[model samples]
Target: MGIVLFALLLVAVVLLEVNDSFLNPQFYSDTLRDADIYNFALNDLPRSALDEARLIAPQYIDPSLDENPLVSAGLTTGDFVAALNRALPPEWVQDMVEQVLDEPGDYITGERDDFSTRIQAGDRVVLVVEEIKTLTRQADAYNLLFEQVIFPNIEDALETELPFGIDVTAERVAEAVRRVVPPEWVQANVEAALNAVTPYVVGETDTFEVEVQLSERVDVALEEIKSILLESDAYDLVYDEVVEPIIKDALGPTVALPFNITISRVEITDALREVAPAQWVQEQAELIVDATGQYVTQETDSLNIDIDLRDNKIAARDVLVRLAREQFDRVANDLPACSNSQLGSLVTSGLTSLPECMPSGGTAIEDQVRGVVSDTINSLQRQIEDAVDTALLAQIPDTLTFTDQTLKDQLAASGASDNADLLDDVRRIIGEGWTYTDQDLRADLLDFDSQDSVDLLDDVRSFLSDGWVFTEQDLREQIGDADPDVLAKLDDGRRIFKQARTWRFLVYFPVLILVVIIAFLGGRAWWGRVAWAAAYLTISAAAIWITFGPVYSALSGGGIDRARQEAIDSIEPNHDFANTQALIIDKAIDTGAFIIDGFAAGVATNAIIVFVIGMLILSAAIVWPRLSEYLYK
Candidate 1:
């Protein structure tokens, strides 16, 4: 009976202690305050959360901006989060964690109705916007974005997608121009015209206002073209293209391109003046003197242009007219002045196929040739303009003014209206400076009651919903098929936990009364009572030691390891801090296991100590009587 009562008392003590460990507020508070868990939550969790948010943020951006160079390059969630992390105070996160830690204790002790804390992300959102403003204002930041991200992407796109086959350099462009307008064709045409006009130059006359004839003029014009090409950097580029292979072979692929080539409208106009001088082109070039103009901006190392020749029709027409005038003046001076004697010589020499030196009835050869050439140039002006414009536009700029308005305009032009509008909205929100405060955020974005105090969860839910309504029915549907019995049991458990401290005293008094009754009933004498109590204690302690020590470890050992591994596995591989987060999780699990192991070891040690005390008392009870009898004998 004594042994059974002692066993009952041991079971009661174990149950009460376990219940107190779980239900007591102090147990949780003390455990959470431990250095390992406290530091892990404080230091690591917030950064991991921010990283996780950055990874997922792209999904929420407008799909239209997915392929946008800015979106792909300058507008990155990682950068935004990095800025936020820099601007955000470390104490803010610490305060939040401290508040959250208090909630568990508060809820358990019935001090709070719910286990939720309000984390105001509004101020942080404003801080991020302010950071963006700061970034926008800095020239170096824009330059970095252009040089590092935008330019590289543009280079890659040009290299792969351009029709010039892999190399998108200025040399490749010059080579393509050479193919389209071959230098050989120009030389051949000039030779044929010079031969046709040679017979007309009977003698060199000092009286002639025009010293050079058609062929000489064409040669001078070609020289002018060459000079223009050289001045515009095209000559060097073409030279590089021609000798690139030889250089590569000699250098064994170590040689880089000389520099990133970019030709603006000013370069094109200057080149045009050499070949076809005209007033309108000069005027247009003067207007666009600031090669770093907003409309013709370049954000990358490689040339990427979207040309519309309609905007430059007058300039194109002026180029054509200048070319025609030069050709006409050449023909008029030399072709009509051919002497009859020279014509006869040409016939006798088998160089003439025409019936007369000039057409009969005062018809001039110069007028006919001039008309034909003008018609030809007019017919092919579109093709000429396209080729020249392409070459000009393909030249990327060395610098660009990166402003918010410029970005918006570019985005809108590229069919990213949503992104443009989004930028506008951001600009509106941020304004000139950091204007929005916490109270303003609460007033605008969050919901408030009559007293102007916001309910944390309600405000959070409302803000996240973005004006979408979610009723009680929606919540009920979400939580469908909840078991009533489970809910009732939860309520019962809460009540029991709430009254545990009072129940602990009740249990302690009953166990003490039982111990007293067992001691009295076990034996008649005081020594016999001590022996009986000691035997009961020894048996009970042995049971506790076996149960908490080896038995508990045997059940939980593999499970703890598997749980830790599973937790580590659950972290996403794409997370930037995946390794660190996994380490933190592993450490947290190890810390928890350590706590459990420590508790079990402490229980086992106490059991062993009680067992030792009880065994000593029982031994004394048996040995003392024998020792006394031996002494008496």
Candidate 2:
């Protein structure tokens, strides 16, 4: 009877193992894949790696959406403060102020047309300002401006503008000349100098040339001057020197001119006729000048001097500007580099323009460029996220179907039994983790980790790293359905998490059978055998609690509640995320969560049923103790 009872326990345990794992539909490869679906959703894939095999799903599901993927991925600004302080750059007003009043420079030498002579090197390239002479002699506004606004404004304009090696001191020379010599004497001397500097009389196509040496003092001083003039600011000085003089010269005490300065066209045309080469050219020059003056005066409506002084030699506007450029270039050309900078005081004592041009920041380009940074950053964030999603999800269906097919092939090859489902169950448990023994096989609770919050798939895959195929093949050979042998030079591999309780249901059944055999041989009564069997059951219940509860907890680590929370809570949705992206993410989370919960509950339920059975046995053990003395009597 005891042996018969032991046989019943063996049957019960086998049934429990089959119901919990070997026969459960969720353990099938296709069903277990749903758990993979859920986790891929909640976690971001950018930092993760992709699973290659699960790229494709079976054709029975939607080709695009149904693939269960294991993402085995390793993976300001201030507004204008009170508007005006920041409205424009701080140097703008100064720039405009400096523009009207310029600086002066020392004239040097290059080449210029000098009809009066055959020019050569080392000769002064005298600028014959015929138009300036005409304008000044006639009291023209152009002449007045040349003496004040234009003259002073450009005192150092060319020198400052040209960054070439030419170092000039035209401003200093102009000041020196003004201080030491009368204007009439210089003019008379300049006329005399022009004739003396050249060997021929003035003609139609003569050019002038001069050569000059650069002094060490000039070069060293000019370097300092250039730096200084870059930021020299004397708008007040400009007004006082250039504008004030103009005002005083024009008005003499009142705003209006002291004399009637009538610089009319008749006066200009008559002057050009006096110098005209012939009568026809003179007539043509007058006609051209008249038309130009009328057009210019009409368009501008200021400085109304509708006078034509067209000459065969040159037009006043064209000739004067060219002459000025030539003069500036002359200072630049033929300038030998300075000897040395040892003459520091000698060089720098003469630099001027202290109140005009200031050296400073020119203009800030980034003020216009910084606005686009904000948009670019946001776009980049979205792009990186999207790219990761694309790469990770790119071949999901392929990976899934590939995995499924590979698993199916391995299962078919095992040749364990004709029941495809049973073979699949064997494959899954063996796949989940390495089975240590037949004892491990029968112990459903031994297949999981002892810790919580571990990724079930990764942990199993890592431990069962030989993969389901090789490990299953080895384990299957060991645990064949008939006459299994657990021990014999087995390689206990690198990692092992848990072991089956040695005194589990299978061992207890056999031990019970041995006791029953001993009782029968010793002639113990049937009632005594029954009482001992019941008493053993009472002791085993405690073993069940000790042995089973924690095993169940370990197996149930992949609980549905935990998985569901990982999914649902992760869906604390991104309101602005695109609708389609959000939908797929949320769905995957749910599917994964549900699958895990199902797995955990299935494991826990198995544990509970076994525990309850133990309790029932305990009650029987209590009853048998009460009956023991009665049976013996």
Best-fitting candidate, scored by TM-score: 1
Residue 173 in candidate 1, Cα distance off native in Å:
16
Q: What local lDDT score does residue 376 receive in model 2, on the 0 to 100 scale?
A: 38
**What's the count of clashing pairs in each model shown?**
1, 48
Compute the lDDT of residue 317 as modeled in candidate 1. Answer: 42
Lowest-lDDT window of 10 residues in candidate 2? 104-113
lDDT of 1 by residue, 1-633 (tens): 656655765665565666556555556556655644645554456556544444544425433223333343444544544565555655565555565556655454444445655554544544544575554443234444444444455545444422101224544444343443344443444344333322222221111121212322333333433333334443222222212222223334331111122323333343333443344333332222222122212222222222222434334445544443444344433444336565445435532122223312244644553344445445454444454344332232222223345435445554556756775444333233224333543465454444345455345444433333434334334445476565556556556666765566465465556656667889897778778777887788788889888998899889998998899899998766687778788878877887787677766776787679879989997788789889999
TM-score of each: 0.42, 0.19
Candidate 1's displacement at residue 93, Å, is: 4.2
Model 2 RMSD in Å is 44.9
Question: Candidate 2 has what TM-score?
Answer: 0.19
After superposition, candidate 2 runs with Cα above 4 Å error: 1-40, 43-523, 550-633
True-structure RMSD, every candidate: 23.3, 44.9
| lDDT assessment of candidate 1 | 0.48
Superpose all Cα atoms of candidate 1 onto the true structure and report the RMSD in Å to 1 decimal: 23.3
